[model samples]
Target: MNTENDNDEKSMTTGKAQRGPLRGMNPIVTLGSAALTLAAMALAITLPEVSLAWLTSLREALSPILATYYVALVGFFLVFVVWLGMGRYKNVRLGPDDEPPEFATFPWIAMLFAAGTGVGLLFWSIAEPITHFGGNPFSEEAGTPSAAIKSLSLSFFHWGLNGWAIFSVVGLSLAYFSFRRGLPLTIRSALYPLMGDRINGPIGHAVDIFAVVATVFGIATTLGLGASQMNTGLDWLFGIGVTSTTQLVIIAVVTVIATGSVVTGVNRGVRRLSEFNLGLSMVLLLVFLVAGPTVVLCAMLVQATGDYLDSLLAMSFWTGVSTDYQWQFDWTVFYWGWWISWAPFVGMFIARVSKGRTIREFVFGVLLVPSLITFVWIALLGGTALYMELTGTGTILEAVREDVAVALYQTIGTLPMPSEAIALTGGVATLLIAVYFITSADSGTLVITTIMAHGDPEPPRLQRVLWGLGVGALTAVLLVAGGVQVLQDAVITAGLPFSAVMLAMVVGMVRALRDERFAPVPGQKHRLAKEIWTGRDEVS
Candidate 1:
């Protein structure tokens, strides 16, 4: 009867002695984070030009390193996670053998998908493919049929297995150590296999601090992007002006809504909202498939999947060596950085909901299922847009080139529907974007507060509100300074150090799994029995 929800309530109401790091909170980590965030905001506000110059320069200087590091790391994650999922360790449960899954399969997958890539997926599903079709550094010429096909394939490569593998690595490590090994549920705990009790000292504090910084910046950047997209949608739908002020107002309103949800507790607020988002997403997806070139979309899905698989290996390790490095830096590198930066937040949320699942189940569910969903989504939505462009039904490529934020609206407008139907679809799309934004913000608030509280599932309500506002405020400042590009640059930069941390966590996880304590209960017995049977059969 002890569901994940029940366990979460218990963790929150547990006595002070069992509060781990939340009893007083780590002053060093907390204050240091606050000081750095305040300083960044101050500079961005008072010396906007100087801050922009520095951010741009930093990005330029780090582009090569970021590109190389991200490409290699992401490839490694894909291979490593697949091996773990299928290897002998697959049967190792994240918790005890008798522990049933915390939530049912559907809700668990829903929550993970929502928290993992909700807003980013919504923002990019239409825009990325259209932009790629317009032009890419690769050999494919712009606006050609080849470029269109390549566009969907590249979208799949970015949002597919490699991306989710990054999340699975961190999530699997944290869940295994915390739920199975009984460590505190924090980034530091993943290092317990490597650092031992030192995880409770300065080393642990450092890991959690880096996690907090990355999560905040990642959430802030995401919020900025979502606000800009929502503002664009509103302007396209209504007559609202698209300006920084309007975006700021939008951020404020969504942040307040997110804060309210945070106060409602995770079981009620986060879980329910995630489920709702999933439902709405399905409705929107069905609308696109039904209303826009159904037969063509289906064909495109099969073709794109084949193209993606054919190019998977090349794309996985493509660092743009001996080619246009700028393309890799802009598209692939930026995505890798963004995914890594967001991993701590997304991974932690996934870990919270993934208790009691085996390593195999967690790996396949996290890496494969959600990725397949993303593939289908991109194929349907992005494919529809490309089909229109190819058939001369709409000029979506032109609109996407002008402003990526309006790409979704342009695509839906091109559907063979009446004006009223198009307007209704636009309305629904806007509503879906807004809800996705709220879910991301609130979930991020929970993750940040949890890390700060030393992995407490239920941090104080006031703390949640404070971090929620902080995220909103930082997002507003970044938007005013340089808009979505600035936010993107910031996330890429924050990801530099955290990427190293992620690598170390992967090593630690391997070490922990090798320990006898983590071996399956009947693993040795089964091995011996198989070996003896084989020998007897050979002798006979």
Candidate 2:
């Protein structure tokens, strides 16, 4: 092994991992992702009008399988993560036996929150519940007690464990393989058990190429959406024009800030930004809880929590096969696709910051803590909207229907605080959205650097900036072309390949975990992956 390491070092020094004069860069992934991005940009620019027609036709053909696949993927991940956290492998550490976590609990959890949801929580916290309250298959009649109850409960369902489970599954597999075993921290490493050294060849490059493209398009879509929301917030607060020029400015500003964050590296730039995002989220959440219908929100929180927990099992598998398949495809299936599309970026970010945590610790912490905070955040913000609608003090549902972007501003507008304080709250909400936007972009930048550098968590600063700018440029071009939805559809297309990749990772993870190093605890028999022909314990 030492001899092999020496040879490998010599090879890297002789430029196996180098691209001519460039050091620590993988040209295949870098150029491949860039080429893919340019192709997508060309489509979005030259043919934005009919961009969705082909994708719509394609998804229509694949809708049944795609929806079923995403649903099952989420369901399988939920069970996999819960079992890891609670069952025999609970004690397995992500690193050496005595290794301590790199970040403290608070910062770790804070960064986890930043990586997972970011701006979407603020954007949807007000919009989604109100949409459901207006009615779903569960309640076609709007503005009723049942609708309100179902609203918050459904929000919990979408934002809760199902989404996080996908992240956890990917993060856990990568962390276990990278840290516990001696592998590079890249998606290809997840297949080492099945592929052996073949992961170092074309197969590995192909997998990573797919991951890079998916991640690039995924984050670009978010930048476009987040910028639009920020544009709306600015117009609502400061009367700025909601022109494309305004949105371009917003995108440029976010790109510069995110680039700055990535340059400082994770310990300072990313970690500080994440902590700030968490703190600001709490400040906004607490203000809403205090200044709004405080008691009613609390009561709603309890009832919503109860409802979410009570109906989790049923709802987890409740695809709209029988009733309103379009509705489920639009909402639940859309979200599942969104999460899957983001798994590479978010999951890789989580794994990078999550060294030294036990499997149990990582699983539960990722699943429960952020999820509980989300519940409270949604209940506070969305619940306040429900209360106003119930009492007829505000037209939140109307605003949501007309324009979901104003939903947050509208919720703040109706707060019982004085007129001046309402303006102050609006400013804070806007700032929160901007910070969430920055956290997400910077986080994606950092994660992309690793993939581009072939899994170096501390990748080159130049490459980091390049990746960050790449995302910004893609968003700007799409925004200017009026083709963000086109880019988004392209992301959904990219995600189909990755969906298969995720399933492969799962099978490899199961096979890899059965190695002798992860033998059963004392007196507890290992769940046998019995030998069928060879001596190795393989799942037959």
Prediction-by-prediction clash tally: 0, 0
In order of appearance, the predictions have TM-scores of 0.92, 0.93
Candidate 1 worst ten-residue window by lDDT: 531-540
Candidate RMSDs in order: 6.3, 3.8
Clashes of 2: 0
Write one digit per residue (lDDT tens) for candidate 1, span 1-540: 745456444433322233443343555566667777888899999998898899899989887877788898999999999999998788787776667789889889899888888888888998999989888866447888888888999999999999999999989998987786655678987886677657767887788888888888888888887898899889988979788899999999999999999889778999999999999999999999999889989888888899999989889998887777788988999898888889999999999999989898999999989999999899999999999988899988888778888888889888988999888988988898898899899988888878777777787777788889998999999889888888888899887888889999999888766653334643322221211322332100
Which prediction has the highest lDDT against the true structure? 1
- lDDT by candidate, in order shown: 0.84, 0.81
Q: Predicted candidate 1: what Cα RMSD to the true structure?
A: 6.3
Q: 398, model 2: CA deviation in Å?
A: 1.2
Clashing pairs in 2: none
Write out the backbone clash pairs for model 1. none
| Candidate 1 displacement at residue 270 in angstroms | 0.5
Over 4 Å off, model 2? 1-16, 19-22, 481-484, 516-540
User: Tens digit of lDDT per residue, candidate 2, span 1-540?
Assistant: 575356334423221255453368677766777787789778867886655687677666766776677787799889988987897678777766667898899999999998799887888888999999988887768889879989999999999999999898889988987776656778887887778768767887788888888887778777777888889889988899778889888989999999989988889988998999899888899899888888889999999999999999888888778886777776777778778878999999999989988888899999999999999999999999999999999999998898777899998898888889888888888888888889889989888878767777788888888889888988888777654455556666777788788888988877766653444443333333324212443211
